[model samples]
Target: MEEKSWSELLAEHSPELAQISRADGEFLDADSALPAWVKQLMAMQMDAVFNHPHGARWYGRRARELGASREQVVEAIKLLRIFGGRPAMATGAEGLREPSE
Candidate 1:
């Protein structure tokens, strides 16, 4: 199955999401009713994608649009760097920079 945005995934599966399906892959719990949970999820996505060379260009705008603040995005990067080390920190930090004018 295609990877869907958290918002799209949530909308596509609301009441059903509350139940844990045996189907494999990353499925968000229906219990993620809190707005922050959704935001944090999106921010963490940046952490994963930031491993790519151009991950910020790939996931930065979408992350914010998905409700992740700049601070949250940066914080997620910092966390990843702490665990993932320098290279992760370097790439992830790029996500925090505002696009050039």
Candidate 2:
């Protein structure tokens, strides 16, 4: 008889909550596997996050600081899958082709 957020629901339902690290440099999916849909959503979100003006700037800067390639930043974006807005998969897909700075 109580209201809960989507994150709470996910925490209750997803096994990843118990396994995935909440800290930096922690392995997210070491031995466990993610559901197909969750993986898809993460991919979409990551694309949306990386394609924004701020996102691109931050990513480029970080990549440069780390001596990594823009392509690596782009790939990391896809792998991380966190976006500002709930970007549609198609938009995220479009981001994949976007030229990096």
Candidate 3:
């Protein structure tokens, strides 16, 4: 079975809000001075710090796909620990775990 996307799930509950979210995502995803991987990594950090594990995992995967190194991801998590404390670091680490584990 096909899985529903985040936007698709959002759309089921609130179409207008989903549209706005999609537009916002498109705008944020536009090409900029920062590379795609950097943007995705930033998003991953924010999600992890904010306690959105699912979003953190999603963004972390995207960042890796875009060429972010494991070291880079670890450094980001360390930064989170410094700024966002241990809980954030723990959550972010969880997001980095392999699915099989």
- How do the predictions measure up, each by TM-score? 0.37, 0.25, 0.66
Error of 1 at 53 (Å): 2.9
Please give, for residues 1-101, the per-residue lDDT of candidate 2 as tens digits. Answer: 78986557756888486345233113222223753323333433444565556534543564445455556556656555543334567666786785872
Quote model 2's TM-score: 0.25
Model 2, global lDDT: 0.48
Residues forming the 10-long window of minimal summed lDDT in candidate 1 = 22-31
Tens-digit lDDT track of model 3 for 1-101: 99998788999999999999988676546557887788888899899878899999988888788788999989888887787776666888998889999
- Stronger candidate by lDDT (1 vs 3): 3
List the pairs of residues colliding in candidate 3.
Answer: none
Give the C-alpha miss distance for residue 6 in model 2, angstroms.
Answer: 30
Return the TM-score for candidate 1, rounded to 2 decimals.
0.37
Instruction: Give candidate 3 regions above 4 Å deviation.
Output: 1-6, 86-101
Best by TM-score: 3
Positional deviation of 74 in candidate 2, in angstroms? 2.0
Q: Write the per-residue lDDT of candidate 1 for residues 12-100, one digit (tens) a residue.
A: 77836633332212233222455543544544555465554354444555556557677876776676666667776798899999998
